[model samples]
Target chain A: MKLKQLEGLLGNLDQFSAPKIELEQYPTGPHIASRMLYTAENSFEDVSDKVVADFGCGCGTLGIAAALLGADHVIGFDVDADSLEIAYLNAEDLELDVNFVQSDIRNLQCRGKIIDTVVMNPPFGTRNKGVDMDFLSVALKVASQAVYSLHKTTTREYVKKTALREYNAKSAEVLCELRYDVPKLYKFHKKKEVDIAVDLWRFVPTPTVESDV
Target chain B: MRLLTHNMLSSTIKGVSNGFPLTIEAAKVVEKQVDMNSDFLKNIFSKIEWKPFVEAAKTLGFSELPEEDVQPSLLDSHEFLTKFHHALLEIHLEEGALVCPETGRKFPVNKGIPNMLLLEDEV
Candidate 1:
């Protein structure tokens, strides 16, 4: 399927009702998710036959696309039970063989599984500073290959710098610019749909050195 | 919880390092025949961890899989593919408990959903 075709399919999935503030739950727009998945499919490493994860998967947009694109297996991780209910329903509706795991990604554990790639739209840390980095920190450690994380367009340089200095990242690149619509969930959002700048950042996760080996 | 999901699940609670291949205790098992996609099955063969697949299959009472791992060449066999398809996609655990190997924590599976929520203290 073409990029837009994927977006059309993902666009049909259910969305959140009242997203929690602490989670900073903003679903990745269908267009961005489709384009990112497409790029990942055609770019460096194809998600096909790879164990792909969608961390902070609110209703499983990225992960479902990976499954649709023929990822060997897809797992959607989220802390909220309510979000997971909708995600499971989406997967069931699509008849896709994907699983939703309810857990805080930071504290979640997957022993012995080597995740080939991670596609996630984590919290940008708008309400809570450094929350985005927290997602990156865990993604770097858990993922064996690379992480495709979405960040605010303005923080591209800061994100790239930190990935290099902190994780000794092998490589980092700004894959694409995505125009996200921040839905008015809280009292703060004035407009019904507000367009914002978001960048899809791909990073080669470097596991911390283990001297015990 | 299907074995495909079970294959990827681990207990990621803080302090527990070895949280892989959680043991399954099925209170309910449902069989739903999803259309077979040979192309997808062919691609995912190599990615499947043979031991975990066999172990999980055994727990779910579908022990028809071979004791030894089938190689990449087995992807060509119709019988193998059919069996693989059944084991991977058809079998489903509507209710169960995925037990953490190290922590022995029970993650409940209700109505085919596995709840992996960790307690506040656990996190």
Candidate 2:
């Protein structure tokens, strides 16, 4: 999609909700912050001949970006019907083909097929019950390479330990951070602060299958 | 199960602290073709956690990924999106256990599907 078109889409919204399965949604304006999109876009520059998946595809931003950035194919999954509707509209508008499925991230079923890359900005643990780790674990299981955005304060340690223990994946901290400034007038806005610190991780499966042995 | 589902699941037992990536010990796996919608994906980019998704794909034995910091072009061509769709939606773990790293909790998969059920003792 052209930058101009994207800008138009971004500008056309007054309030945008995240894909429904997530605990919360962005109150107004494009649900995603433009800066975050730019950051993610830049992050996938070298991806090629790879299948990419965008989990919790609120409005299909990441998947669209992946296609634009040269991913061989992109599939997006979300649980919200309304969000999926908007996501579909956005994909159509951009003239980029994407696969958007309506399903909970927890119970997703993709038989034997594998993708080269996966990307997501899962619910920040702080929003509801602080269980974002569940989202991270699943992402690790389905993609060869993955990128995750999380709260800067708590996610680093948790992500590190999980990556090491589960898939034996190695991680590197990217120097990028996203901060959202919420206007103070709202009841929940006691000066909202979201520190977006992302970790880039890669998994190399152990040669445990007997075929190699 | 899709990597997206694996990420949100936990051992659900009473005190399992880390249940992030449910390990798949699949006894049977299957794949299916699903429809595509590009506009929907474009709108939901921020909600994805890319790193773990990549890790999960690798575990399944796929290793082609773009480098970090590249811009995805929506208008590049149809060929690119078609290939991406196959990897992201078609891959399936028919049977497997999503083992938790912190608690050693195991969620089993039967018949190309993962059973994320937790026992009362686990909860």
Candidate 3:
């Protein structure tokens, strides 16, 4: 599907009814989401016909996008039950069969390399330090092909260094920087809207080499 | 949750080993027709654990999948692909619980979505 059409469909999906500050539940707007999934499919061929999982999927935006882009199967994982409900409705509204599971990304356990790509807009770890890395850590382990995620632009060095050294990523590269317009979802926001610069990253995990004993 | 998603899920409670292939406790199972993609079925067949997958299918009231061991050569048969596609993608556990093999913890499935969230103590 064309990028414009993809964005238009995602724009209609329901977002959070009551945003939870603790989980850093912020809606991933259609602009960045379209670009993220578009690049994954167009540039890298990491999306279509692949088993895609959306980690911390909020209202199923990214996973639904993958479905729209022809992903054979999509599974969305989120800890919040409410978010999963909205996500389920979004996928249903689009007539897309996307699976959703409610689980903390940190504790999620998968047996084999079934997931080909993981696309997520994780919490930036503003409230909980290192939580963003925690999400990346699991995404790296779960995804066999690549992980597409958004992180704070300022943490570019830290994100790359940790992914390569600690998370067993073969390569980590920032694709582009986009403006994340965060609306006043919580009382802590003094302004009506805050624009934060975020970098879209694609990290490739090191292939697990079989050994002869 | 579809059987495809169930194949990837396992219990991650504190120290439980052998948590894979969570047993299906089906109360309400629904099926939705989807286009069968032979290529996808061929690729995913290798990744699926046959015994548990067949068992889950039976619990969901789908007894078409072969009970015995399946070889990759079965992909050549369109009949086998149809059965595999239906069980993996079409069957949905609308209301059920995935019971952990080791700890016996039950993860409830509601509205076709599985709640795999562990309690704070379990985490």
Instruction: Point to the candidate with the largest DockQ.
Output: 3
- Top model by lDDT, which number? 3
Q: How far is A122's C-alpha from truth in model 3 (Å)?
A: 0.4
Error of 3 at B4 (Å): 0.7
Candidate 2 chain B, which ten residues in sequence have the lowest lDDT sum? B39-48
How many residue pairs collide in each prediction?
Answer: 6, 101, 0
lDDT of 1 by residue, B1-123 (tens): 668777767776677877776889988888877667788777656656778788888888899888685788888888988888888877888888999889899999987778888887777
Write down the C-alpha DockQ for each prediction. 0.43, 0.04, 0.64
Candidate 3 lDDT over residue span B63-115, tens digit each: 99987858999899999999999999999999989999998889898998888
lDDT over C-alpha atoms for residue B85 of model 3 = 95
lDDT for A192 in candidate 3 is: 99
Residue-level error in angstroms, candidate 1, position B65:
2.2
> Model 1: runs farther than 4 Å from truth?
A206-213, B14-17, B32-50, B68-81
Best by TM-score: 3
Candidate 3 clashing pairs? none
Instruction: Provide the lDDT at B45 for model 3.
Output: 89
Candidate 1 chain A minimal-lDDT segment of 10 residues: A204-213
Candidate 1 per-residue lDDT over residues A81-164, each given as its tens digit: 899898889888998878777777777545433567888998999888987887887777667678898999999889989888
